[model samples]
Target: MKKSLEKLLNKPLPVDPFMPQRAVITDIEELAPDHKKFSFAFCDESVNDSWNHIPGQFVMLTVPGAGEIPISICSSPTRKGTVELTVRKVGRKTEVLHRLKPGDYVAIRGPYGNGFPVGIMEGHNVLIIAGGLGIAPLRSLIWYILDRRHRFKEVYILYGTRSYEYVLYKEELKRLRERNDLKCLYTLDKFETEEDRRWADRKGLLTELIPMVELEPSETFVAVCGPPVAYRFIGKELLKHGYPESQIFVSLERKMECGIGKCGHCQIGYKFACIDGPVFPLWDTKNLPEMI
Candidate 1:
């Protein structure tokens, strides 16, 4: 019996190898004042291929002289051929990326980090919260859920920006809100004019609107992405409403080099933000330093 068991365990198992290679930027589009979207296709057609990424996963982008940075996959898996990323021009790498146009070449490392818990979120109401550039990553999960709307109970999206002019995906948000299957809300810190106020749906911080929204804590799962300050405040409000820590997912931003966990730049405690997570359960690392 022992010999038979050993023989079974020794049998070869099939696995797919990870491919890391150069990809060319086939398209680039401006999304907001400081944000741009880049589209890539594999340079080596036979070996390097388009990525298979779960919502919330990110890729490390490298330019020869500028260095590398981890940017989230904003495009949905439902889209084929090319993958897209929305980058805000806030740092050296991004500024370099912003200067590059279509036909430029860049190195792509991975679709790293654990993604949103789609399997667990299925059948539960989803409440997505995004602020500023945070929408770049959360857009993936939102598209995934929208692609298979019937699989979930209800979907609600609340997005906040510093001003009306800073909102991302305004047209897309307006279209999605029209769908009876989903509910969407847009808020700003304050309105700039009477015309802006007429179009503005919600005002004040997003956390303020959270209290008035109707949701069943037991049946709902919340996903939040934003700057560190945004997470600190919104997280506290979510907890106050009795949302379990495990049910709250957050995407953290950090400096990253290699997206394959080979570099220590993105490390937080013992966790590598690029590999172990960019997305983590709120309670999983709530006690870890710099996690907030």
Candidate 2:
């Protein structure tokens, strides 16, 4: 491991962190009514081949006239040459992004934030809990684990959205549900119609699934990403199940400007989300009462 780190540190990066590289949209897939996935390829061959990022990290996507926003990299580094972003049209910049088409160019920089620690997670069972769009970032970690399946133990995924229509990655989740190696359970908050009940595995608050996960707390690592409200409840549920704060990891959503830590937009206590984390062990962040 040390030798690999040395080799990586000795290597030269293809693109500077501060300079935005030209990336062209290669494909676009609408995941939901408001959410879409955009795939990009660097116009420069060198960067396209050498750019690497760990799961849970994010990139600063430029929207030209609208400005830049920090977006989680939904694609894993194992998939070379292209990067992907799953975005929802919620604001001005994103609204502009929604209008983008294949062949259009955008400036991109990063692969920032301290991503999840995959090395420490090796040899342990992993429970991935995502609520709403939280799956966007967790999706990267999920694929990385699946690609290198031999390193980890049992894997379980529980995802919850407001309704069946709001669920992202429908086709991909369907494929995962059919796999024998892992478990996939999806739920909806409001299953008013018969069609909703037929599509989802269950219906209720995502926290309800905690008791259903059958893993030894000591041997499992739980990675959670969701709304701030979900974190408060989920943290308590994991504690009740005997998982230490250290064994639980949470991704906090923050407003970020200048993806590097210069702007204080993403400050939590003394830590900067852009630099210190967007991902932090619950033990590390438990003291920051305001953040949760």
TM-scores for all predictions: 0.88, 0.94
lDDT for each residue of candidate 2 in 80-192, tens digit (9 for 90 to 100): 87999999999999999999999999999998999988889999999999999999999999999999999999999999998878889888998999999999888899989
For model 1, the run of ten residues with the poorest summed lDDT: 11-20
* Candidate 1 ranges beyond 4 A from true positions: 1-19, 46-50
Model 2 spans with C-alpha error above 4 angstroms = 1-13
Q: How good is model 2 by TM-score?
A: 0.94
**Residues 1-292 of candidate 1: C-alpha lDDT, one tens digit per residue:** 5335435876422212244568899998777798888898877553233346889988777876898777889988777668789988987877888999899999876778898988899999999999888898889999999998889988888888877667777778778878998888778887887745854577788898678668888889998998778787898899999888889999987777666778698889888887778888888657784777
List of clashing residue pairs for candidate 2? none
